[model samples]
Target: MELPGGLGGNDAPDGESLPELLRSWRNRAYPREVSETAAPRRRRSGLTQRELARLAGVSERWYGNLERGEPAEYSEGFLDRLSSALGLGEAERSALYLRAIGRPPTSAVAPGSAAAAGMDLTLQQFLDNQAPNPAFVTDLAWNVIGWNDPLREWFPWAAQQGNQMLWALLAPQARKQLVDWEGSWARPYLGQIRYARAQHPDDEALASLEREILARSAEARKMWNLREVHEHADGDLRRLRLPCHRGREVSVRIVALRLMRSDRLRVNVLMESGRAVGA
Candidate 1:
C-alpha cells in the first residue's frame, strides 16, 4: 500500500491525521469526481473521511478509529460496504479486508478481472504456434479468450460464444463430440459451475448461467443437484468422438496452466493419450 508522492504510511508529521488506509481512501475517486480535475490531481485527492463515512452509512469517528488502525471488531459485510462506498478496485478491497479482518474476503471474485475479455498476443501466438496439439486460454469463468486452429478442430465452437463451460454443458456439438456427455462433460462442468456459484454467491452472472443450464439441460440439472464441486480439471482424462478422426474415439489428458501475471488466466493444452485412425 504505497502512498502518493513517495510518502510512507507513518510519515505523518505532528497533528494532521494521514492514516494508512485513510490516505488510500482519500485517493479513491467517485461521487464527486469533477471532469476538470487532472488524473494525477484526482489520484492525489478524493472523498474526505467524513464524507466517505457518511456515504458508507457510518459515523466519522468510527471510520477514523478504523482508519487509525485502532483494534475493533470488523465484519466482512461492513468492510464490503466500506469498499463499495469508497469505490475501491478488487485488489484494493481485498487488501483492505485482509488488513482489517486478518483474512481475505470469501466473495467469489473473477480471477483475472484486471484483464476481462482481454486477449494477450504472446499467449495467443503461443496457442497458435502449438500446431497439431490442441491448446486454448480461458478466463476464470471458463471464457475462452484464445485458442489454436488445432483446438478449433476439436472444439469448433470455442470462438463462437467463447464460454467453455456453456459449450461443454449445453452445446449440441458437445453432445455429439464429447464421449459420454453426461458423465464426462456436462456433470463435471456443472460441478465446476456449482462450485463457482457457491464461492461467488453474489455474482449475478453465475446465477443466471446456472439458471440457463438448469432450464436447458436435464442432465445438468441432475448433476448440479448432487452437490459435487471441484476447483478445476487440471489433469483429468477425457475421451472425444473426433471429426478429424472420422468419429473415432480419442483420449486426451487435460493440462491446465495459470499465467504468472494473472492466475485467473488458464492455458489449457490437451495431451493426446490415445489416437484412432480416420475411418
Candidate 2:
C-alpha cells in the first residue's frame, strides 16, 4: 500500500531524499487506514505537521516547508525545539541535528541565567542526605556547585577550588591526596575534560577553563595532547589519602547520577568502604 507522503517502501532506499525520510518517519509515526469512500478517512495516531508546529511554537507553513524539502535555513534553537516537540530521544535528537545541521548537538547545554540558579533544591537535599558519604554535584564543566558536609570536612581544599577538573589536574594537594593520582584521578579527569571540550568546542567558558589548566599545569597540557576520552562508570572504586586524617587511605565507591530536568548536572557520591581507613 502506498503510504502518505510517498513513503510506502519496506525500507528507505540508500541515499533517500531528506524529504522522503521525514515523510516516512511522519507516516510511520501517524499511521492511518485509507477507506474506499468518497472522502479518504484520516486516522490520528501520531502528531500532524500542524500539531508539531504548534508544539514547537513555529508556523505550520515553516514546518511544512521543511517536510517538503523547501530551501530554508533553520536555527539550532528551532531545531532543538522541534526535536523536543517530536519527543525524540538522544539518538533521534542527534540524527535530527546531523541531518538539519552539519554537526551533532553538543552534550554541553548553553549556559545562561539558569546556570546561576544551580541545582534544584530537591537535588541539593538529595546530596545533603548522603551524610557521612562525601557527595557533590557538578555541571558539565565539572564545576563543584553542591556538596555535603562530609566532603567539606574531608577535603578542605574542595571549598577553595570551585572547579573539580582544575583541582584534580593543577592543584599540588590533589597529587598527594589521591592514591593513584596519575592512573585514577588525573588521567581519567583529563579524559573527561577532553570529552566535554569535544562536546562544546565553541563554548568560551569551557575553552578558557581548558586554556587555564594547560597554562598552569604541565601535566594537563601533556594529557590534552594525548586526546584521550573516558566516561565515568557507576560503582567504580576510588582511593583517597586524606591529609586531615594523618595520611590514612580510604577506598570509596563512586555513584554518579544525572538530573534529567536540568542540563546535564550530575550528583557524585563517594560511599566509603567498610574497610576504609581514617573514616
Candidate 3:
C-alpha cells in the first residue's frame, strides 16, 4: 500500500514533486554539526562500481543511479544485487532501501527537546517497580528514557555517559560487558527502529539520528544496511553476556505498553526470567 506521501493520485502538482519533498527531508536528516558526505565512495577496498555491478549482475550505470538517488526503477532483485556487492547484512540492506525510497534511516531519532515530553509519573513508577529485571523506556530513536538500578548494576555499560541505547552498543565497554551484544540485543532493537521508519517517513528526529549513528559506528553502519524491522511488544526476551560476572548470560523479557495520552511514547518494562536472575 502507498504511504501518506507517495507518487500516487494524491501527490502534489507536477511543479512540486516527491523529489522536492525528499530533498527538504534530506537536508533536515543531518544534525546541525554534521553534513552528508559530498561524495559517497563507489569504489573502495579495490572494488569499483563496475566491479560491484558485475558482482550484483546489474549494469554499472543503474547501480550508480541507485546510489546517487537519481530517478530510476528499483526492484527487489536490484536491491538484492546491491546488497551483495556492498556486503550488507539485513539491517544495512534495509537502510539502503529506506534511503533509496526517500525515507530516513531506522536509527534516526530526535534528541533533547525533539524527544516527546515527560512521560506519565505512574508509568515511571511502574517501570521502577520492575526491579531486578532490567527495564528501560526509549523514545522512537532508542534514547534511554527510563531504566531501573538493577540494570545499571548488572550492565555498567548500560549506565555509561551517553546512556543512549545506540551509544551503549557502540561504546567499547559494551563489548567487554555484554555477551552476544550484536546478535541478541542490537539487531532486534535496530529492527524496531526500521519498523518506526516505515511508519513515520517524515519524522526528522528519527531520520537524523539514523544518519548520525551510521556515520559514527561501523557496527551501526553494517547493521543499518540490513533493513530489519521488529515491533515493540510484550514477550520479547534477550540474553545479555557480561564479562565482569564471568561472561554470565542474563535473559530479560521485554514488554511494551503504548500510551494513548502520548502516541509518541511506548512504556517498556523488561523483566528477568529464571536463567537471568542474579546476573
Best by lDDT: 1
Task: Give the poorly placed runs of model 3, Cα more than 4 Å off.
Answer: 1-116, 155-163, 243-247, 275-279
- Give the least accurate 10-residue stretch of model 3, judged by summed lDDT: 29-38
TM-score of each predicted structure versus truth: 0.54, 0.56, 0.51
Off by over 4 Å in 2: 1-117, 275-279
lDDT at 11, model 3: 23
Residue-wise C-alpha lDDT for candidate 3, range 1-279, written one tens digit per residue: 232345222222334433343333333331221111224434223345554444443456766665566865454434533443344445444445554665533332223211334555676676667776666665555545555676566644333212245445555555544457778667776777788888888975566556555655788778868987777647876666654346566666767777777766666655666634234
Pairs of colliding residues, candidate 2: none
List, residue by residue over 112-203, the lDDT tens digit for candidate 2. Answer: 11244366677768877788788887766565667777887776534322557765676566788888998888888878777777877886
Candidate 1: where are CA atoms >4 Å away? 1-115, 274-279
RMSD of each: 14.8, 18.5, 14.0
Backbone collision tally, model 2: 0
Give the true-structure RMSD of model 2: 18.5
- On residues 63-128, what C-alpha lDDT tens digit does candidate 1 reach at each position? 888888776766543465466556666766666765666566676443323245466778878887
Which one wins by lDDT: 2 or 3?
2
Error of 3 at 134 (Å): 2.6
- Which whole-number lDDT from 0 to 100 does residue 168 have in model 2? 69
Q: CA lDDT of each candidate?
A: 0.64, 0.63, 0.52
